[model samples]
Target chain A: MNLVLHNFFRSSASVRVRAALNLKGLAYEHVSYVLRKKEHRAEAFLELNPQGLVPALQLEDGTILNQSLAIIDYLDGQHPEPALLPESALDRAWVRGLAHAVSCDIHPLNNLRVLQYLDQQLGVSEEGVAEWFRHWVDEGFASLEKQLASDARRGRFCYGDTPGLADICLFAQVANNRRFDVDMSPYPTLQAIHDHCLELPAIVDALPEHHPHAN
Target chain B: MNLVLHNFFRSSASVRVRAALNLKGLAYEHVSYVLRKKEHRAEAFLELNPQGLVPALQLEDGTILNQSLAIIDYLDGQHPEPALLPESALDRAWVRGLAHAVSCDIHPLNNLRVLQYLDQQLGVSEEGVAEWFRHWVDEGFASLEKQLASDARRGRFCYGDTPGLADICLFAQVANNRRFDVDMSPYPTLQAIHDHCLELPAIVDALPEHHPHAN
Candidate 1:
């Protein structure tokens, strides 16, 4: 099946899809969008994703699927090698719950659109925006720290030894923490997971810096 | 299998789980948390869900799982009948994409905690908060309307005639839109689905007014 990915270099959501593709050993054409320039808002891109979000997948049949988790799940469903989720349904749900802890609860607040709203529309100061950014990172990280440090299922990654969905999100969140200068001294388990994932080729190539349009 | 649902009566996320349970014909013990009264923040609740969020499901073995979508996926997996997700992998991904469009995009920023943070911490006025509320609701509703209205697979619910995960999320969002007084005239398709869902016993029983805690 032909696959094309429309993504922003620095988007946390896009990073997950990139990592998923790399992990699954699926090859795809990469299309970069310079979000600051409003390239994603162009009519063509909107036709692909009405939500105007990045990390949309265009399948061989011209069916476009948006939302990074959904796109990753699709890829995982289509190509199950090095499976992204656990075998048992209960275990998969637990992993997804962990992923959502980061993606649903944390990332949405820090999305480019949300930050832009805070700045351009709410007239928040740069410092205020930075504080806002750090605030959410800290809140989510604290809860995650407690969850992961306590969970017996955690190994080298957020789940087992292999890197998967939750680890991808944890990796991205760690990057965001570094970008925003949020304190990492509090989350040792997360730090270990982040470090473990960075050692992998799939995750390493998917970092924002590896993207063609970084900065 | 034993099941226990820990939830807030009015939470959209919790409402999704409630609707899912009702649809799946799962007879589980109902454990309510008074979110406004800080009942969810208690130590026991935190033990169940480290994040202090509600709609956690306790399994027969006493293992608790969090996140509404993950819980639904778990339920659907355990009880195959009345499947929450479609049969084909691609169809499932599309359904998941629709669900995330509501759960991850529209609901997160409008969550009770986020709203409280905006009002108490950021000092956003009531009107400002309502504007913030409507802004996200409109952004998500516009895209969803475009998606559902354009899809040839449109039926009685978000997917087909079945009231599944996406419809549960859509149901909660429609309720939220009404609670916030967001204009409904613009999203005719959503209004129609909302009306369709209200006719179903499962969805009707899951509405906030029918909950044990609603004022």
Candidate 2:
């Protein structure tokens, strides 16, 4: 199965899909886009994904899957060797809820584009932009830490034992949090899970620093 | 199923879940919280959902589901008759991608909390707040209109003749957009889909004004 991942090295969303693909043992090539350079906004890339977002996976059949979670879902469906979600519907909901807490509630607010808007458009100072970043992360990670620390379902990863969708999202977000100096001491559960994720080669290889086009 | 939905009347995320429940013919009790009053931050509500965000569905066994899309996905899995997601993996990817375009890309940035942050913390004026809302809607809608209009899979709704996940999110967001006076002229495809959604009682009854706690 040939796959081409259109992504930037430091995109948390890209990190998610890359980790998922590696976890599934699916080999894929990278088509790097320098998001800061607006390469993602180029006409050719726009044709691939009109959303102009990175982490689009192009299937061998020319189908492009956008949205990191959606792409991960599709890959899970098509592969299913190491499942990304749990078996039961209720469990899947739990896992998905954990994932969205990061993706929807935090990452979207702190992503490069939103930060750029806060700085360039809203005239927020650099310190203010960093504050904005830490703000969302703190809000999200606080609850996530409480949820994970209390839930008996949480094992070495977000769920029982194996790394799944929630773990993928958590790992990526924790990595992104470092850039903003987000205080992980407040989130021991999340910090531990992120540490556990770091031990896996599949997850480690997906890190931005390990990306082929890392600056 | 003895479902209790803790949500605000006008939250777009709440609207999405409400429409999904209505579409699936699931009966759930409303537990309203006025977000502007910080009612969601109440200790009781925090016990239910540590995240303290609304649209949490409490099941019979007392398991609570948070995140609107996650709750919708759970409902779809439990009640498969009126499926929210498409059957095929690739098709499901397309539908989810469209849904996330609204939920993750647009809704999160334009939600009450973010707008409040922009206004209170950053001192963005009323018009600036409105501009911020419209900017994201336009950025997301422009690409979404392109994707939906160009794709052969699009029908009366975002995916096919039937209203599904994408339609639920799109409809809810368009409703939210009305508050900011977003001009819909640029997104004819989305506008048409939103129009189609309005014709359904399931969708119409889920509107904020129709909620039991609407002020």
Judging by TM-score against the true structure, name the best candidate. 2
Give the C-alpha miss distance for residue B111 in model 2, angstroms. 0.9
TM-score of 2: 0.99
Worst 10 residues of 2 chain B by lDDT: B1-10
Candidate 1: count the clashes: 0
Instruction: List runs of model 1 lying over 4 Å from the truth.
Output: none
Q: Candidate 2 vs. truth: CA RMSD?
A: 0.8
Error (Å) of candidate 1 at residue A110 is 0.6
- Expressed as tens digits, the lDDT of each residue in B83-133 for candidate 1 is 989998888888899899999899999988888988887788899889999
Cα distance off (Å), candidate 2, residue A182: 1.0
lDDT of 2 at B36: 89
| Candidate 1 pairs with clashing backbones | none
Model 2, chain B only, scores a TM-score of 0.99
Pairs that collide in candidate 2 are none
TM per prediction = 0.97, 0.99
Native contacts retained per candidate? 0.78, 0.86
Overall local distance difference test of candidate 1: 0.87
Q: Using lDDT as the measure, which candidate wins?
A: 2
Alpha-carbon local distance difference test for all models: 0.87, 0.94
Number of clashes found in candidate 2: 0
